[model samples]
Target: MAAYTQDAILLLGDSLAQGKFDRAGLADRLACVYVRKMDVINRGLGGYNTDWAIPVAEQVLAQQHEQHRVPRVQLLIIWTNFVHLVNMVRSPASAYYSPNTRVILITPPPVNTHQRTDRSFADTESYAEAVKEVGAQVSVPVADVWTEIWEAAGWDELACEQFLFDGLHLNAAGYEIVFNSIMKIIEERYPEIHYEKLQTVFPHWSEVNVNDPRPSLVKRRVPIV
Candidate 1:
């Protein structure tokens, strides 16, 4: 197989971003959509709060300049706890600093106390709100995951459990909600980068003329404007 490099969509957060509950987490789901257009880099630090993520995020950005193989970061999605959301969004030096790169802040989903003893839905909601507020202040997109999942469950606490694996992490269904929410914002705000609108590397097999495949197989680069 031939090896190639493309721009990246960076996913930075905690366990949820790491896909602890669902191995095919946000990054995986996005990779399926972007296909060959971009690489989805999951820099999820399990059990990490925003304080730790700040320094790490800077390192990732700095290292990007040193590594030629590391594609430029086109989009950065930060899905951390409320405490970190503010710093991540407000700090101008983080990954979101680039004018060429877009950013999306994802608030954590509501937790079900019945199934998990560590977190509470009430606290999650508060944190989610802070994320939204920061996003507004920074003019960055914010995905109110807590609200989305809660409404999807018809605002029923017990019904909300369907979206979680252990009341803390998300299951497949829960991840779907997060994926859709993020995609919706991307479609609305960054339509140029939308996967559906992106051109594939090569033409479909049926579209290629066996006698002159190269002419049909190669596509010009689609600049992000």
Candidate 2:
């Protein structure tokens, strides 16, 4: 087999998961913590819902035969609405069924009705609940970001303004809640792949031999456990 470098964590979702607008988005935060341990791949698309994400996932995820050449996806963080996407990876009948890949579902944050007239507060709440339901049915761990942000805002729909900048998209404070929620799930359900538990692919600077640094620079494989 060819030399394997680093394993990866793929983040898939809409704009919220994309984190292009906010520097403190979940993907960025995870990268910071998981640096050198695992590569974080963000595949979030703007304004895309469940329908659009399914096809894109098909294209992005490697097929069974191509798995050898590509970096293994150790963790897949899905923020989009999916029962199909989960099936694609978890179902034995599917081509993308990756037994080694761990999956986590994330709910969209609550909408701020006070600042936005397009989306209703009830509707957004229902959407979050639906994502949780899908996660339950599919047996995938859920981050439940909706509930976390709501509780952070003291359960007031109007008070969600503190987290959301434009009533729809999240600001720094909002993304902080998201990062925390995802980390909690990782620590509880997927501790093996947690940053603290894994070693870096490359040796730390101090581990390098001053007389022969080349030998110390060789990458090491970080086992899941």
Candidate 3:
């Protein structure tokens, strides 16, 4: 069998990261946009805060290192609830173990209290600020979803509901904001790794020669140094 390989974009967080709200969540939108260039992995754990995610994330990085898979991590996106912002921000730093692995800390979006009682908008904002502080301390990029979504909604509570499926989780419109923000960061700071700039695994079908197809199908092998 041919060894399969691709770049990776890892999503780690709670119910929001897991895409509990919609079929097409953050990871899904990114996958569609970066199709064939990178594989988007969703490691979202429902109801688990950042404290629980620390060890799990460490193990995941270790496993990836040991496995020596073709799909190396290019981007690691993390977003979780406010209850454990401090630990969550500190823990995901281990992702740097893999060289060239870019990290993006996403703050949870604003909550619509009318929909649920598990959390409050004020509480979530404080945590979002905490996440931004962590991102700055670690020198990692932050999506700041909380601020972006609220601004997009013109800071109106009722208007913001369109971005969320429930009081806490993001809906399609909300995820789009995140996806755009992330891509903006990548485009500005890490243009080299931008999906549009990367080459596809194979040439476009129109570019392939019909006769003597082996030359088109097989790549020239390079000698190991």
Candidate 4:
């Protein structure tokens, strides 16, 4: 494993990491609990999948020196599934990434509308499985957002109706929940980043209202249009 003494988080992936929550911004809430030395960068692009992650990764490599034994510039929090690009980059994956990079793969959550009659559970499961499969190529840790919250009241579930202002995006509370889950995963699996105390990325975050709007649970299913 490449060891990086730097304090930073490089988030890359799809719109999910881009904060699809309404009521509570999942990534915003996450910034509070990092509780360590790190810089968080949200590089998630809407509509991106695994295939596209390659070029992005390549661009990142350009900024690095081709040398080992050096600290990494950032920690990779990739929330992508560019399956289209996988085949192109799979062989000699070393060409795509620098030795100084550490990776965390976040699986795509079930963005499909869940109706009692809709049978797309399998698709979410497949997305989760795809995350694991893709991670194998890069040898990175995969955060199975799909498995973590797939069964947990989706758009079809009454508890999740209001949770997602719309059918796919999460409300503030919804983002908050997912944010917490991500923190727990980082703490447990990625001990290197587990700073003993809360670390602040933004200097002004302290002045910001930490609790302007307290988190609340909403369980009303939005009617299907």
How well is each residue in 1-225 modelled by candidate 1, as lDDT tens digits?
A: 534446778888998998964466888899998887888899989999878887787666634245445456678898864435444434566443355677888989888888887777688888888888878877888888899999998988778889998888898899999999999999999888888887665556798899988788775354783
Q: Which stretches of candidate 2 lie over 4 Å from their true place?
A: 1-4
Q: Weakest 10 consecutive residues, lDDT, candidate 1?
A: 81-90
**Candidate 2 lDDT (Cα, whole model)?**
0.88
TM-score quality measure for candidate 1: 0.84
Model 1: residues >4 Å from true position, as ranges? Answer: 1-4, 63-69, 81-97, 206-209, 212-220
| Backbone Cα, N, C clashes tallied per candidate | 0, 0, 0, 14
lDDT of 1 at 119: 77
Quickly count the clashes in candidate 4. 14
lDDT of each: 0.78, 0.88, 0.73, 0.55
Give me the candidate number with maximum lDDT: 2
TM-score of 3: 0.84
Model 4 lowest lDDT segment of ten: 216-225
Q: Best TM-score goes to which candidate?
A: 2
Candidate 3 C-alpha error for residue 190, in Å: 1.3
The count of residue-pair clashes in candidate 3 stands at: 0
